[model samples]
Target: MGIFPGFGGWINQNIQQPLKTSKRSKNGKSSSVSEEDRYIQGPWYWDPDISPKEKAESMEIDHVKSMPLSATDPRYYDLDELVRQNRLWNSEKKHPWNGAPAKVKVKTKKGLCHLNIDFTLGSPPQSVSEMFTNPRNLMYFHSMGKYKYNWRTRLDTRATKVLKKDGPRQITEVEKVLRWKILGYNGTIPIHLIIDENHQKVTATYKKVKVKHMKVFEGSWKIQPLYVDQERLCKSRSRISEEQYKKCSGGKGRIGSKVTMEHIFEPSSLLNVPPVSWFIRGIAVKVTKALLQDLREYVITYNKTETVDPLVYAKIKESIQKEKETELKELED
Candidate 1:
């Protein structure tokens, strides 16, 4: 035999045989692979055409995509009827005056509360990222005076690091002190937040900053592009004629940013007075919804009045196009 077998048979046995092996035993039983092992074998060993760097990047993308968007995400929360039946909860009991988005959900467990909020801004991802990263814009949106939070006053604000580059991510951390008048209690609260930005996503996490009225106050904010599903695009195109689809730029969906915010905190005052939990939750819900709405409005207004630099806008647009293309390719494959 030539090298143990003919060329075609040897190739099949040596190259493709392992892939065809059932992930089961001869007893017709299924064998589960550990996540670590699967991760190693799935992308690293399977795709020989991809370079190591490309494989790493693809894994990173998959990881980012698989991250939990919120506590309410099905990946983390069970939607079974029994699970829902045992729960004691109320959602959207009090709507904010500015109107809350449908994606907002508030959940309370024991004495702790969580808010899962999702919204979309009118501007592209780059513009939204710029607005969030800029201190001036942040102050304008968050300062008590700007938002007219009569019950709260900003005492001082500081940033340890405005911006630092780590590999492909930009990191920033800020601290603020605010005086609050809640339930006839006057106290100072400190807030600390760290923001990390890569090319495709921005994540903001609140550190364990001490606050007089809060035992625990921490959360995360994530912003990424909202990708239209390929199947949806195909259906839309099928509905329209080819000429019409071409005129509409092949029915390419409008590019927008998807923002997800998760807030988990327990106010000392609220815990001290269990009856007022509902009141506190209402305030938190209102404030969170109002802030999201304000940000959305602000981005729309900013885009209308200000235009990003030609070169910067070009780069942002190109990055967005690349993301869209990648999403489409993944769907196709």
Candidate 2:
């Protein structure tokens, strides 16, 4: 039988009787709480009265002191090792997500399993003022929404106004600005999604991308510094006579005296590079009851009971020293 689309493939295959246990509570009492309530139970903000900056600083200090090592190496996440350990743990666990037993399929590849997390709440921001409350969600929305297509709004109004006073120059500058905005939106989101996938961290950034010019131009185009092209002009064919050059000064001084061209190029072009789209994505290892309690208790107790164990201590030191040396070598190179 084919598994349902939205329900994960693994969950559908493993589940024999989905409604039986889920229909009733563990103690055979009716389930009072909703599934949505479980996810929303966590504290959203850490006492808003105390500023976020101060709270984050305190948390940072606490986290640093809590970990054994000053920095935990993300590179040390061994898939095979974690899978073996997780499987062993899973065998003894009873997962809470599903009332029945749950298990994770360990693949040879590290990131083959998909962890799709989506909230039912549609398009987070209720108003412009509310945007500040949820930056991460807002950032993702902005990148995907207004920021991408809203380039004209972001342009420096003072600069655009000054250029507009010059008639023909205004048209050129406006067109250039519009082109930049369209290109900006096209590339920002897609690359950001890729970066989010790789780093396992949330970030907001304008991603520069390369793309084939379709409507705007005939071929591939790229953004570049203006001077890079302007500086390489071939030998001048028409030399203005000294009198002509001097006449350009309006008789105040020597010709061309006030014509020393210095282009303070604050110019940026959002060239139509390959288009990119952005999305909010994340991964989470579900805490489940699939594991045996005795083994689970042993692992947690082993780490907590003894502050300093010789064998474990040796292994930790060896890993840290090796890591330090590797980092040092990279720095030296």
Candidate 3:
């Protein structure tokens, strides 16, 4: 719906997919972001380190951080547990209008706040993962709800910087500007994140860039295919086959995505007092929930709509074709 002019053309061009550079002309410019580089890295378990490194094939790494999609990597948050609680929460059959259909909770852990969110979407995990990470969809993404818990109603978000590293696995260093209001006071937050996009496993692993305002931030998003046809849980979710996915889709041609996001973070402020810290943590929880809500609503609302712009469709098609070409190249190698 061209509701927003040119889909917010005012958005910085860095947020769009960067131009591909061949081996001969690589990393020429845009190498160092002097503006954002000074912020530093946080003390999170999965901090984003863009330093040069040895290839995974030549290294004996034990952590997923070393080799994402590694079988030995810590699963971090448990999807099975979250999905169980989500079912229980929804089965109660009593919820407020804005009460998200997911199990969301936040608690103070050590000196930081830990938040875990779990929910299921109607689309397949691949589709959901692709839509959320694709830059083409970000401008069109927006939340919808009239409930009091809707904080995004007073939020303005834009991608300020994005560096897309395209390869067998896409790595992106991005920073976003979030302007929000609370208690009639306006505030702006800079969220710098390193996104490890693994479409093969349907996961986006993100770690925070330790900016001056951010003290701690690390997280991972895992989307698992649910066997919607049967009432029981899926026995295997990793790289599921097309036939099995179809059989488990409940005949609607629409699969389910068991989505979970886990993050721990703290602000770089001195509000360490009892109630002040609690209040700050509360704000963090609200912001996390609001962001997740926006994504869910965008996926559900737009996936079925026919108003998707032809240009956006073309971009997605091009992306998929390029990805397939890359996959074939790796296979041949």
Candidate 4:
């Protein structure tokens, strides 16, 4: 029933006002997540037939704006096409993936922009995946707005839910209720996404669930080994231990993952109009890049800070408690 560390911050950071930050435990340790993980809600609430109108009402949104683009517009990209030649961040010259001022990037395109945020970590792809792929990590890993007139432009996300179909046609679905505010103007966008996780490709593709509007929001996450040759060389040394790889190889080297989260965002007709359209689009792009910058900080502090992945350590304790309960039951029987 009580709030845990950092969870409320992620939920309220994007809103017009921020919530009171949650406090840590007595020893400054984070407690396990309670069941009310609205951002990571499970399939029990899934309904493939729920109309978008009904969904809007649930969020207390009175209006759903009209679409400005056609169904065939290139801006409304397919999930697999989330990464395209249009990606600005792919260029190592102009908007390099690995760069400083995380919120910075190359020029964005009209109506949409594909953001590729690439970074390396101290751990391998599997550890990075464990930190990211789990919904529980959403609470622990985020960078909130620092100042009042924060230079960072971004969408405020309220809650996220994982949806699925009951039948064979069901694929993983992710729904996010995001708040958009630019230059004192604001609106809400409810996005339903279809998630495609390809293990072999080491990528997760997300596209709009059922594209009703011309507005588009789709993206892909690519996580793969960064310094393979360095990793191989690290293992070649018998004396060098697993923990030593983070510091020993060239000082900045660790056989970590190169994570690329590419997103394509285009707003609806309500905000896509002339006067403020350009400004809003630019804000969206910057906000996304800012989010990537936040992720950089989030990942770096994962295991080393007060905020750690709840699902990982919490699961172990849960399993042990279950085993103890089973033992008590057997003895009583």
Candidate 5:
């Protein structure tokens, strides 16, 4: 399905308004119409000529709540419950130093610190990896208006190369360099991120990306299998066949994936102050949550549309099947 069904009609109704061109009067003066007003469509003046009962019904229909029509729509989310759960999870899983979801461990000898955060995503590792590695998708996640205030953000992929690969379960390494910049930023932040895919895990790592705000910035995103109980799996479904549940349960339970993001960075002197650290941490949490939420929504939207790449989807399906087979083998052993 299209991201928004009936989007053409929506554009006609809400965006593509017909404009009335401005005209100068014979008296060498423009009419009362302002420049901005001339570009705006005039207010609706057509008489509906409908019955009072019909008008009341129309009003009622306009006020009636409807299911989400698109991934970007606000009605698609349970905002209060999601926020509450995310906050509670972050609070309960905080590191000792700061009350953030990421653990901070200082390496006194090396004069550096590591920030580690782990969470579970709803999708499989292949889909997550594909989304994260794509330059366009990365921009969508990072340049979210609510989370990022900067404008004119751009992401350019400099190069991509496959280094080496073994079997499906063996290590497959790929490297990519990206140039990123935002409006008002002095210079571009060039990132060299490496992606490692294996049977058991997929990881993306970047070491030291120099930016104006930080002396050091490095991070890794890793995904690995996670198992959940049958009861939990059943909560996601209304009904399940006994045999089907047993097969999917794989003796232990249904399989999911745990995603971890780790970063180590030293801020520039301007933002290295004590108070600024707290503010930065707050922003980091908000942005991270927003990124995850957007990723989930984007994946759902992509799956519904016909624009998905067949080759990539095939690889993802194969990887998932392999994972299931591996899990079954492990159970047998």
Candidate 6:
């Protein structure tokens, strides 16, 4: 009847932890704590430095220009491979996951782009529209374009009931309608949907729809482990009375180990989805220690240099030679 309520309660789902930035004490001592020992609560939203608009723009530009993530970096090739892998994961039909499309509108400092898609009318209620129109969603796509969408119902509920009786499949048909959003150059677009039964269509043109690439950091999720904190709880007392010594004998020597809590989850997983939500539901859970170890192997393979796998080194050398040849030929011309 209303928008879905916020999730509540503690979810003890096991997930992997992303790399965290933490500062050491002035003495420059390494934390004796293992990351796994930390516990954190969730509904963890992935926070990238740039706004979603910026991400969309970057992706659009990269795609439209057929450019790699980093043009100036040699590792761009490898990074491109990674990006391909990321997109492949999203587009796979077996996975009900969709990587956010980077929508961009390129103009001559003053142009527009239009997009058109049909909607099924009466399939969504007013509450769904309200959710789509939420401020957060609006701002997320504001730079891409303004939405001018409408839905026309093809059949009433009563008529649909009659149609279901006659059809062997007994499936009710939703109204077909077209939905569209329009945006100026460098505008953000909101991704909202409406239903229309009478399939109508609309068209939109933009100066550029290809923006920039989404910056996906190397993400890992794992179960947080218990940790012992060693910070001193209070100043050391001199000449403890026998009674006092007995009272705190077991708790001696600069903050004994204490339990730590941390939160970890899949990088691409949605924050709003409930814990234990299946990976097929677009929330990645169930990452295990073994998966992390395997991923580590891949990362290590990518990192090694002077002594790389012979085949890999040979391929790299061949690529280098070809690149050099191409450069020389261009220079001669």
TM-score for every candidate vs. truth? 0.47, 0.14, 0.54, 0.48, 0.42, 0.15
In terms of lDDT, model 6 sits at 0.22
Cα error, residue 249 of model 5, in Å, equals 6.0
Query: Stretches of candidate 4 above 4 Å error?
Result: 1-110, 130-133, 147-170, 179-188, 210-214, 228-254, 314-333
> Global lDDT of each model?
0.44, 0.22, 0.48, 0.43, 0.40, 0.22
The clash count for each model shown is: 0, 20, 0, 1, 0, 57
Candidate 4 vs candidate 6: the TM-score winner is 4
Instruction: Give residue 27's error in model 4 in angstroms.
Output: 28
Q: In model 1, which runs have C-alpha deviations exceeding 4 angstroms?
A: 1-102, 138-157, 162-164, 177-189, 196-199, 227-254, 269-272, 306-333
Q: Candidate 6, which segments miss by more than 4 Å at Cα? A: 1-291, 297-301, 304-307
| Top model number, lDDT | 3
The better-scoring model by TM-score among 1 and 4 is 4
In model 4, the worst 10-residue window by lDDT is: 63-72
List the candidate numbers ranked by TM-score, top first: 3, 4, 1, 5, 6, 2
Q: Is candidate 5 or candidate 6 better by lDDT?
A: 5
Candidate 6 per-residue C-alpha lDDT over 255-302 given as tens digits, one digit per residue, 9 for 90 to 100: 111111121222223332344233211211111222222222322222
The TM-score between candidate 2 and the true structure equals 0.14
Tell me how far the alpha carbon of residue 304 in candidate 5 is from the true structure, in angstroms, after superposition: 5.5
Q: Tens digit of lDDT per residue, candidate 3, span 1-333?
A: 001123123223434544222211243333333332221221011101112342323124432222311111113332223223233323322321122466788777667888888987755554456445533223323546432454343233233233442322446665555644456665767666787866457687888874435578788889886644333334444656646654564332334678888888876667755677776677777766766676667555554454333322323444567789999999999
RMSD (Å) of each candidate, 1 decimal: 19.7, 29.5, 14.6, 16.0, 18.4, 29.2
Residue-wise C-alpha lDDT for candidate 2, range 27-60, written one tens digit per residue: 6555544331221111021211234464445444
Weakest ten-residue segment in model 5 by summed lDDT: 63-72
For this target, which candidate reaches the highest TM-score against the unseen true structure? 3
- Residue 27, candidate 2: Cα error in Å is 62
Model 5's number of clashes is 0
